[model samples]
Target: MDTQYTALARRFRPQTFSEVVGQERIAQTLRNAILENRVAHAYLFTGARGVGKTSMARIFAKALNCPNTKDGVPCNECEICRGISAGNDVDVSEIDGASNRGIDDIRSLRANVNVRSMRSKYKVYIIDEVHMLTKEAFNALLKTLEEPPPLVKFVFCTTEPNKVPDTILSRCQRFDFGTISTDNIEIRLSQLAEAEGFTVDQEALELVARRAAGSMRDSQSLFDQLLAFGAQHITAADVHRLLGTAPDQRLIDLIEAMIDRRRDAALSQFQVALNDGVQLEAFTDQLLNYFRDLMVAACGAEGVQLLSVGRDCLPKLQEQSRRWGLENVVAALQIFADTKGRMQRVTYGRALAELALVRLSLLADMERLDDLLSQLKAGNAVVASGTARPTSAPPPRLAASTSPVPAPSLPAQKKNERLTPPPAEVASGADSPVTGSRDPAPIEAAAPPPVIAFQPGLEAELHRLMLSRLTDMTGTHLAKVVSTAISGPNRLDFSFSASYDIGRKACERPEVQARLESLVKELTGQDVRIQFRTVVTEAPEAKPQPAQPTNSRRKVVESPEDPLVQEVAKTFGIERWLRQEVLAEVVEAPAGGDLPEE
Candidate 1:
C-alpha cells in the first residue's frame, strides 16, 4: 500500500502552452490567437495518442478562465485555473466521446451548451476520442459546432481526424500535433531523473525514448515503470530485459549472417533466440525495426540522422549498409514483413520465424535472369549463392582463365572451340596442331557463322534481311513499314510509328509476323517468335553531324568546300552554302601577314 504512487506522466503534465514538445509551431499560433482575442468558437485537436492533444485543450481553457492570466498563460495558483486543470470547474465540461456517443448524448450536450457559465466567461466543452460518435450523433452535433453560442467554446480531440465528418471538421479550427522526437524525449527524461534523484544511465534513457515512438506521455509512463522496478538505478541491460528484445550483439550477428549469406549460422542464431524464451512475435518486430534502421543507414549520411539509435549502434550499421544493395535490403524486409501475417495464422510462430530467416539468408540467390545471362556470356566463375567456394574452380573461360587454352564455357558444347580464337602458334602455323602441315587452314574464311544470341543487336541484321528478302517477296512498302526488329530468345519484336497505323495493323496480323519469323529462321537456322505493335514517339530533332572516328583503315571524308562535296551535300538537304562561304574567307586571306603593323 505504501509503494502506491501517481504516474509520472500525469504528475508532471504541462500546465502552460510553452511546455508542449515537438509542436511548438501549433502552440505559438494558438497562444498568439488567444492573446489577440481571435479564438474560434469550436476548435478540434487531432493527432496520435499521448501526443498532447488533450493536454493542449486543458491549457487553452486555463488560459482563458484563469483569474491571474498573464501574456495568455494560465496562472496555476488561481482558483479557476486549478479547477479547470483538475476537470472540476463548474463552467468547464470534459466529455469522453466513447462513453456517450449516441444521438441522445449529443442532444443532452446541445441543451447544456447554451446555459450560462457560472464561474468563467467561456464555458469550454472538451470531448476526448471525439471520432467515436455515431453517424447520427455527428450529424446532431454539426449544427452546434457550426454556430455555437458566443460564451460556449467547444474543443473536440481525437486520434483520428479522417473519421470525423468533413462538415463538422470544416466549422472548427483544427490543430494537428506531431510525435515527440527522441532527443526531446531524452532531454525531458534527463530533467525528470535529475529532479527525482534517479540514477538512470543515458543509454537507458535513449532506449526508453526510442521505445516511446514520439509520445511524451508514453515515454514518461515507461520512466515511471523503470523507477518502480529498479528503485535506484536503471541501465541499458535493464532496458533490454524490460523490453524483451534479443540482445544487441545477437541482432548484429544475425544481420551480419544474412548479409554474408551464412544461412546455417543465421538459422542457428535464430534457434538460440527461440530457446532463450524470446517471444517469436516480439523478436521479429525488433528485428524488423533493426532492418528499418539499416534501410535508413543504407541511404548514407542523410538517412543516418533518421535512425535515432544509440551511438554504439550506428558505425557498424553504416559499414554493413554499404555492402547491402537497395534491392537486397528491400527484399529482405518484404520477406520478414510477410512472415508477420503468416505467424498469426499458425500456433507455432517459431517455425514461421525460422522459415523467414532462412529465406533472408539465401536472398543473394535471387539474382535477376538478365544478370545471370550476362555472367554466362562473360565466362566468369558464377558462384552459386549460399554456398562456400569450391576447391576446384569452374570450367575455364575467357573472364576467369589464366592459360591461353580455350574455355569449356556455358554455351552449347559444339561451339566451344569455334567461339574461342586459335592460339598464336596455331594461327601462324608455327608448331601447328596438325602434323605435317605446311600451310594453315583458311581460318576466317572457313570459321562457322557467328552464333546469334537473339539480343537487341540482332535488330540491325533483321533490317538487312527485310531490305533484301521482304522487298523481293512483298515489295518496298512492306519492308519500309517494318522499321526495325529487336530479338530475344526465339523471339523478335517490332513496332510501327503512329503515323503508319495501316502498316502497323497489317504487320500485326498473324500471317505477316509468322512469315517474317519464317524468313529469319531460314537465314539463322533457328525458329524465332515474332512480335509487332504500334507506338508513338516525338520526332527526333535535327543534330549537327559529328566528325567521323579516325583510324588508318579508312580514307578522310571529302573537305566540306569541295565542289563535289557541295553538290552531294545539296542533294541531301545539307547547307553547302555555309561551308562555301567559310572556305572562301580562308582562301581570300593574304599569306604571311598584313604588312607587319608598320
Candidate 2:
C-alpha cells in the first residue's frame, strides 16, 4: 500500500526501539544488551495485544542488523533498515507462527537456521504468536532454540506467555510489556489527531482511549475511524452519539439517584435513556464501570490507578463513595452484572434491569443473619432438627427449657421457687387492697429485703447444659446422673449423685471449672464461684409400720402448670413437654370414695 493510503497502525509502525510507545523498560533493556555486546540467542516478548510485542520484535531485529546504529537505534535510511521496515529481507525472516505451527514447518526452519546469513551479520527470525506452535513443533524446535548457530538469533512474540512450556520459557530471555495507561494512550491519540490535522475534545479522546483498553494499535485504529466519521472536528457528545450509547452524564445521574434512593428520579432517567435508544445491556455495562470507579474511590487514594475515569469524574465518584460503604458498592455492581446476564435470556430485560436498580437502592435495608440475631442470648442453643430442616425459609426456633433437678439434702422445690419470679396477675392481685380498715399501721422505717446475687436458675441451667453438651464428653460422669444446684449469696453449688464419681472428678478439673464459670457469667452476668459436690445416699433401715393394701394403687396428684411454667412454656415453646404427666394407675378402689378415672 502507498504510504499516504496505509492504515495508521502500519503507517506509524516503529522502525526502532525508541519509536515504540509505552514499553520504555523493555526497549531500554534490549538497547543496553546491544550496547554491551551481550545479545541473547533467543528472546521472548509477552504482553497484551497492541502493547508493542511484535513491534518491539521487529525493532530488535532492525537494531541487530542496522549497519549505521547509534545508542541501539536503527538508521531508517539504510538499505537493511528499509528492507526490514517493509518486512522483506534475505537474511531476516518474519514468520507468522499461527499458520506455520506444524512440526514440518519447524523442521524446515531448523534446516534453514544452519545456513549462513545471506547479507547481514546475523540471521534474525521473528516468529509472531509463537505460542500457537503445536506441541510436536515446540519439541522439534527446542534443541535448535537451546543451541542455535552463533550466526542466527530468534525473537518470539506472544500475547499468552503462559501457554508456552516452562522448558521453552527457560531457554529464552523474556520481557513482559504492560497495558498502556489511558493517559498515555490519550496523549498519543492527541498527538496523532494533531498530525492528521483534526481537532477533538479531550474527553472524546479519552473515550477512544478507554475503548482501546491500552492497545496502541487498537487506539490508533479507533481514532482513525472516528476521524473519518467526524471529518475535521469531534466533540465528546459526537463520540457518544456515534457509539449509540447513553452519555456518561446520564449514567452518572442514574447512579447518583439510586445512591440517594430517589427511585422516581432514577426511573425517569432510565426510561429517558431507553426511549433515546440506549441499549439496556450497554447501559448496564456503563453502570458496572461507574460502580467500579466508586469502589476504587472507596478504597482511598492508594487504589486510584484501578479506576479508568477521568479528571472530571474523580470528584463525583469520591462524593458518591461516601454515600455507601465499599460493601454496598460491591453489591450494587453484582446486582447490575446479574441483570446484564439475565437480560440475554429474558424477554422483559427492562423489568429485570429495573428490579436490579431497586435492589441496589435498597441495599442499606438488607441485613445479614448474624446482625439479626445479635440481640438474642448466645447461650440459648437453637439447633436445627435433622428431620425438620426447612427447604427455603429460615430454620424453626427450637428452645428447650431448663429442667428442674432435685437436690439430695436441700428442699429443692421451695428453694428453686425462691429463684423464680411469681405470676404477674396473681402477684398483682395479692398486692390489691383488702376490705379491712383503711388506716395504715404505725411502725418504724425498716430496710428492704436483700437481693439474691447468684442466679438459682443457674442450677436448671447447669442441668440442661450438662444434658445437652456434656453427655457426649468421654470420661465425664456429670452427665451420667441427674443433678441439682442451689444459690448461696454469691455461690452456686452443683450436687450430683454419688454413683457419678468419675463424672464428678472430670468436672473438678481447673480448665473445666474455668470454662463453666465463663459460661455461667455469660448466662447470668455473674462471676460467682461454682461448687461441684456429690450428694451421698444412705441405706435406710427397715422398720415395722401399719400395713397397707397390697393390691391397692393410688393416682399421684401433681399441681397444674404454674405461672412460671406457663411463662417458660410460652417463652421457649416447650408447652407439650410441660403439659405431659406421669401417673400411677389406680386399681379397683373400695366403695364410697370417688373412683379415679381409668
TM-score per prediction, in order, is 0.66, 0.65
Q: Write the per-residue lDDT of candidate 2 for residues 50-151, one digit (tens) a residue.
A: 998888887888889899989899888999988888899888899999999999999999999999998899999999999999999999999998888997
How many angstroms is residue 83 displaced in model 2 relative to the true structure, after the best TM-score fit? 3.0
Q: Distance (Å) between predicted and true CA of 14, model 2?
A: 2.1
Give lDDT tens digits, candidate 1, residues 1-598: 5977778888788899888888888888888988899998989998889999999999999988887888888889988988988889999999999999999999999999889999788999999999999999999998888788988998999999999989988899989888888999999999899888988998899888988988999999988888877858889877766776666778889999988989889999888887886667768887887777778777765434444356688888878787776677777778888888788888978888888888876656564434544433433223334122333322222232223333223444342122232211112322221132223243332322223334554465445545455533343445545455554567776666688777767766787767877666655656878776777878899899999875555333336757755664465454534354444443333445332121
lDDT of each: 0.73, 0.72
Model 2 lDDT at residue 515? 74
Clashes of each: 0, 2
Off by over 4 Å in 1: 1-4, 301-309, 368-370, 375-598
Q: What C-alpha lDDT, on a 0 to 100 scale, does residue 170 get in candidate 1?
A: 89
Give me the displacement of residue 47 in model 2, in angstroms: 0.9
lDDT of 2 at 349: 86
